[model samples]
Target: MSRSTSHSFSRSRLAALAVACAAVSGTLATLPAHPAAAADVAIHDIQGATRISPLTGQQVTGVTGVVTGVRTYGSSRGFWFQDTRPDADPATSEGVFVFTSSTPTVKAGDAVTVSATVSEYVPGGASSGNQSLTELTKPTVTVNSSGNPVPVTTVSAASVPSAYAPQGDPAANGSVNKLPLRPRAYALDYYESLEGQNVRVGSSRVVTASDAYGELWVTVKPHENRTKRGGTRYASYEDQNGGRLQIQSLGALDDFPAADVGDVLTGATEGPLDFNQYGGYTLVARELGDLRQSGVERETTRAQKSGELAVATYNVENLDPSDATFDAHAAAIVDHLRSPDIVSLEEIQDNNGAKNDGTVAADATMRKLIDAIVAAGGPRYDWRSIDPENNKDGGEPGGNIRQVFLFNPDRVSFTDRPGGDATTPVGVTSAHGKAALTASPGRVAPGDAAWANSRKPLAGEFTFRGKSVFVIANHFASKGGDQGLTSQYQPPARSSETQRHAQATVVNAFAKDVLKAQPDADVITLGDINDFEFSGTTQRLEAGGGLWSAIKSLPKHERYTYDYQGNSQVLDQILISPSVRAKKAFAYDSVHINSEFHDQISDHDPQVLRFRP
Candidate 1:
């Protein structure tokens, strides 16, 4: 995150934000004594039955409601108030957020008449593709009375629609912003209808663990695409978990209990429905339910048999020699992952990680990890990799993070050919119907623009039990600039994928070249692909039957190595050539040691595959 992170917004929207900022610059002020009369409307009618408000950008004078919730904390200080009398239509929400942008004089249960301008304030800005939040901005309030009864709508499992989102109007360019709310049909529309309303959810299962930001995710549909590890698996774009809801407290997070996945929040969890950028719609709870521990535990994969060759991929999250997680990572590799014959470690930083000094060597880092693995009762692993140019790879500055191969010398012998360097391109050479690497432990197309500012794939050749095997470890471009799933742009655009697709194309071409050299070539390409197996990147890599992601072999519910915002999905993968997949004896397991746990050594769970070569 750069300090100068900026977004380009339309002049009109920029002016609106400027006016909003100026409205509540210092303190709260009451309504004007003499004001021009304007058309009065109910809160639901103001909210309308569409994604966008019907009275957007209009000045409304008379609005009466009871303050259901007040948020005096944070920069966006305001209160949620609801009309005591709701309209007959269930599609329109009865509540709205008063964007004071500062501390308010009113409290919950205070009945008041508000004169304010209706504004559609997009949470993360319109350019972020987030849906606009209907708010009463630059308001003038006159208190009528106190201790008024506020309505609390109970939202049970039956209330949430089975459908996730609406099919956007094709004319509107697949944006549901202009679509009418279908409260009984679509979940997004249903939540949009209840935006800012006081609601309560019955006992729910915690899907995402509590984070440092004092937030947790719970699902009303507890059994929806659930994983054995007690998480909701995000299978595909069309099959997303609809019941997932983010939960936050109005009060201090210190009072909120820490919880893991599968933990239960017993009883009713009441809050005001609000839409934000972090995770789309959220429940800002005023009273939190008591947490019931679920007793979740880490998982270990079965060790490889004597005749089998085990290969694993793990993203250590920028590990260096001095990090405290070395012991834990070593143990995870040795005990949980069961000490595979070869491990592809991503994000292995240079010695003295992130230091600006021109020290690009990572021998110290590798030695430290190897020593820890040995201490943890694992093999003395020999390693091979190319040190990336300083800051050339897209990782922490000066860290020079790159993919590395840690192989047990006792189990496998590296086919070390000459002339392998950081800037050299590794190629395939065919002789006597056998395929061999031009350079051992070499980079694939180091000078190609596809790998610009990204980790280049490291290709290594080894002989396992007199059978030659080629492995290409890749850590492709990340998904930083892509639009999120809840974006106003339906089926949000993945802008960062252009580079990943190019990278995948390059690696796939290289693998195809090897397969062309020998049709039965045993080639394995694996690492942090940074995209799902169902995505175009994966398809590009699996093009022409060059390689197949072994993760697909597992059951749909068990096909996740990373969890992002409670969606158990895949990022790391181990792909095998058709020759290896053709073998009858092949097993894959994603060791669940990290992602699900709050205290994680790495954000990714290590995946291992064993096969007779």
Candidate 2:
């Protein structure tokens, strides 16, 4: 006999007496009713036509499924269950989350019947514009059997759509939120249809390396706008790669393996579909896949040719004397980047290195790095910089980071002139038919509002091969207060871009002043602009046809100096005046090292530009 909490059935067959009793009525009735009448409800029935549950606020009974996954510790204490027999409709998912608010009593692979009240839970509460999750709250589980087989659904190229998102509704503030669900026509719809389902992925390439948050982004199709390093190239706002997906491990942090770009995730990985704040739709995997290294190594640029001057830009990421990354950073400049003739360094801290005892001199800090470079078999390079007023520069608290210039005295000579300080603004002038700085190694427009609380531009004059080449180093305003793509705002606002635009205008005007002074002057303006090549900030810097970004000289896929969220984008740039731009004998390379690797000394990869003046 089989019995439920509300009903019971007989095991023995009925005798002829029961049959004879119904014979007079011309109908033969069995001892018990049909088994389906007691268990007609399915998981898909509760998860109805829309994102919200159709039977919400109504208590349902006899929902039967096999438990597929269980979360024991987190606040979202729940177990995922899928119906033994799925529906034919591809739009409706057969799996649903059963929230118990406590440890689940039944383990995975157990066939259990549940009775619960359906509810929709939003992750960020009511005000957040995030999608709602359908769940069964206040659930009571009755284990029917054990060791049941759990079904795994394979997600492949054909399963997802080629489009990233559906066309937004013009009436709904340009949001795709109201678009009808076409599961096979868009990536967002495809993920939404499988919400809370158990899925498996086959061999895939790692797009983004494993981050500190224990997440890895991968792409099933490796040939779609892929970079040489295995990362998907985000061509523009319109070409978002739909094959990208994130793999989040639900196991121990230490058990999660470290991976780099171009690595492959082999074997089968099964997990439950979860939508969270970090990435749109993530697969929280209980079993992680194996990582296979692609034998991809960091690149070393060719050494400078005879009579060619090599200039580089590096953002050391708040290099302070107290930090121990100096030696590794120097080796990158010496061995990997080939020790350029002149390098512009940003984020150099004060002598005391964040001690903040009113100390503004960075002589000791500069000497330490210069010594480390020589010890690493690099050239004996001389440096010039002006210390900022105490705590005026914005960076790590008390760090007072600023830009500095490093040059090989044997290859180039710095033109020394008087009257340069931390507060004075420098102007461009014509001297001996070339562009000259009013104060050599001086700050440009220090009093301008665009430079307030920011690292001011440093201009220096140097002579290479009997020709004067002017270089301007800059560290602009950061990209802060920018909303993420998954935020409530449809096309999230880039709030930091306004200040960066103003900062670019200032730099552009200064470049124009230099170009106006000498039309054929060899001027290179380069540093960590903290913006992308295609961004408006770069366009503004290149406006008036005065300066051009050297990063544009390389192919679009090879222009990135930084990686974020699996997308390799450009942040560091080298812009040159028209004189240098008009020349045919110029080359640039964005050295690949720090950004794609886990063991990085800095967060940015340095860019090297070789040219003859």
Candidate 3:
């Protein structure tokens, strides 16, 4: 799946409140400053030693701190203030956000007293599994003084813990919300302990590009899981790449720099550390660093040799005939990917593209791309795909996004067996010890519940270098319902994996069927898997030793096709059977192009695998 938008707390809080419902709204209501609301404890005491605040749901009075930052716009506007005098406990945060539900009059450096209800505001929602943000909501704030200097905390490699998260409590059913904050050991604990505080970071490398919402990602621990191209590699779930932090500006979007991966943010960037729905811990910058272009160029994979059959996977990010990026996408395929002999395309939409008028044919979409490819100096390509039943395939509604195969006729041939349709199930068969598909361009287990409302695996038989190669193109179920990495659950719930694991088993069974039919069958499966190589999904795909994720063949640092939230992780991959994997000379490349740049036509870096079957 692709990612998104503005890191605004107000909008996020609005959604969070709506999701948490009116009961939470009532609990965190504002009241006039009175003796009843006068607990008057230090900010750190309220922040407590755990992910959840100790003073949640309590009315507190005379809470004093210096305003470090203020959000005066949007429905959930508030000001972040830090206590002037701090206790010596590292487990408690000295700063806190005061939610007013409207514009705040206080400015940075103003000393203020707040009488409000302390709350553990969960971003997204309580069910979203995200860590709760400790906040003083619906406050009656009184400006006590002006021009007080806001204390700034510097964050660097040495300041952040190498460990990412703490173990969840078994009593709480894997919830870490009540666990004591291990600020010195866990990165999440460290960030949580400093939430709402004024923080500063020096010049740093931009890992994820500035998205459409004028936000980017930076890392303080530069060397943690460092990729060769200046990014972090999220190799596994256990190693969450703790140093990565999202960057957002409190100022106007027009002033925010458009930065790409490998760019450097020169000088100092300072802001109040806050938690939002889109990304967990973020620095909403009052002062932004200057963006310095690092001259990072799109990488080109070496052309496939005459003996090698080059197969690739590229997710065009919901491409339709009307899409404007056709030319740019064509150029990437020709110039950057060296025009792989066979490319598996994901998220190819219908002609009308989200019109939702029951249209399902995608001939126009494929034709536009093929024509653009030819114009970009690539060979004329032939594509095969099955149009899904309207609204059945999950994606942009009415777009009817489906997996497609594009093969170069000059270099390879597509086997077009008859009778393959939207609902037809593909079966593996053997003809004279050669593996073949019952319906060449057919759906794999189309009726299976595992593929409900998702793109069914598109199976096709092909001939390359006079050798039969069976390829199963898949755009598996996305990570739509999964909990975020910064969830309250210590090992945050990957709820989406259940469906993917089932999908993998379906694909795995199909591959095993073909292997059983033809023992020496050369089978390859590749597409936007929407999961990591190390996940249960991949494990299911590789279950019976029938298929192996070819991306794993590369060095650990170089095995990613997408850069998400500053972690270079694998979402797209190519898997091959023992017939292909046994030939260890096969080369694989996660061609660096779209995902690293803001000028991307697709959010995925295409994966290319070259092997002599």
Candidate 4:
């Protein structure tokens, strides 16, 4: 979630506009005088057929409309007006944003006419390739009357485009961000055409739960590929699912409805189309529809069957002793995820936890977590890990987050060996007709450039039911610099995946070496891979069929372990080797204790897999 740091409109003009446009009664009094040569201009004519305003850089006179909404605060000090009379073409919207640079004097239901210069304002300046918003700047307002009904246009399911964006210039390899608008065909184009228009979205389903910022994302098309939880899935690259729209209530924050994923919005929600930095095109709702809960609840704890070795992976989101969320996290692991025999824990911060004074030991942090788990009715689990060099790992500065292992002593035992450290690489060796690690809990290819400034994979040797199994815990590079879905560049750039791909290559190679040494080696590579199951990083890891994602055993909609913008995407995965995949006794479940709820202990949900070795 992002906050608006800068004003959407000019701040300099705000004070003057506020003083000139004081609150007035319903009666039309002290109307501003108009010029003798004022020519009537329709809102649609000014909007034009394309995204760029046709009458830009020119002064237009005698623009008339009924005020549909008013924004009194923020940099976008303006009132939205819709034309009482609309155009025949559905592509052109009959509304416009009049920038007053201060508190809007006009109120909803007021009939008004204005003479102003048509200007196109590009947020973040000209260097930003973002779409420009059309506005009437430096305006003189005249109140014709009050209590006039505002015109509203309904956006039906058929109006929503199926395609997300237009095919940019092929010569530029889609790098050319700007392209001509196709309002009829593309989703972005269709929304841009209705920018600043008073529109109604009817009977929409909530795809994203409301965030801390009081924002919700909904889909108007009910026929889209939807999850059982009521969220529309990003099923394929071809289906963009243009029905999605962001809902923003700029009114009193308390008035904004609290909604969750799978909720339904009944009746029509009336709002003016707004384009901003956080989300491309949002509906600034003046009247919200009724919210209906769809009875979606968090999943229960997974069951572990007899003669099965249960393993799980969870990203604890920088857990530390100082953080107050440890107890809840422990309860989630014990009560909700069913306490797997061996669990890969990621983002375990240093002992001090965010105190930048160069403390790297996490014994205190780990002990506190283990104690809490025991108090929560879980087994006494022993742990193994190697501390990273001070501040070398990339994460919250001073946090020094790394991966650690927790194994139930009653069910499993660590096969401890020598020569494991932060910089040394772990290798595979044949022992007793089985594949084993040189060091029981050793780092994998730590000196490789691919592991620089990132958490190194921790490989551990464990024995369960007289059988040896190896588990590699990894925390890959985060998606920090990836372009947002609403980015000006079509098919937004995923630059962060480059490092993750390199990391995946090294891990995959290590897994293959173990398989080569012992054909039936039970190697389980699991942790917060920080990429989607269908992503290129996952494909690279499973390229040679060395590892198989256990999450694939479930249905497509049930594969998510993280939620972003209301889309449940996979970030944490438990991938098993062919020896585990070939067996038909494997069972996998994504225990959903956190991601969907508001008071989440971590951003990611835990994944548990049970298999017989």
lDDT of 1: 0.83
Q: For candidate 4, what is the TM-score? A: 0.88
lDDT by residue for model 4 over 1-613, one digit each (tens)? 0000000011332331221121212122227534323438888888877667889889888888888888776556788887877777766778888877656778888888878878777654444445567778777778777887778877867987777787656765553234656777888888877878888999888887775555688888876777666777665445557788888775766777777778888898888887765556778888999998886777766667668999999888888888998788888888888889999998899999889989988999999999999999998789999999988887877988899999999988999999999988899898777788999799999988887788999999999989989899998888765655655666767777899899999999999999998989998999988887888889989979999888889898777787665466778898899999988989999887766665566778888989998
Q: How should the candidates be ordered by TM-score, best one leading?
A: 3, 1, 4, 2
The candidate, 1 or 3, that scores higher on lDDT is: 3
RMSD of 4: 5.4
Q: In model 1, what lDDT does residue 471 have?
A: 94
lDDT of 1 by residue, 490-512 (tens): 77777888998999999999999
Q: Which predicted model would earn the best lDDT?
A: 3
Choose 2 or 4, whichever is better by lDDT: 4
RMSD of model 1 against the true structure: 4.5
Residues 173-236 of candidate 3 have per-residue lDDT tens digits of 8998898888889999999889888999999899998866668999998888888888889978
What's the lDDT for all of these models?
Answer: 0.83, 0.76, 0.85, 0.78
Candidate 3, position 166, lDDT: 85
lDDT of 2 at 164: 65
Candidate 1 Cα misplacement greater than 4 A, ranges: 1-27, 30-39
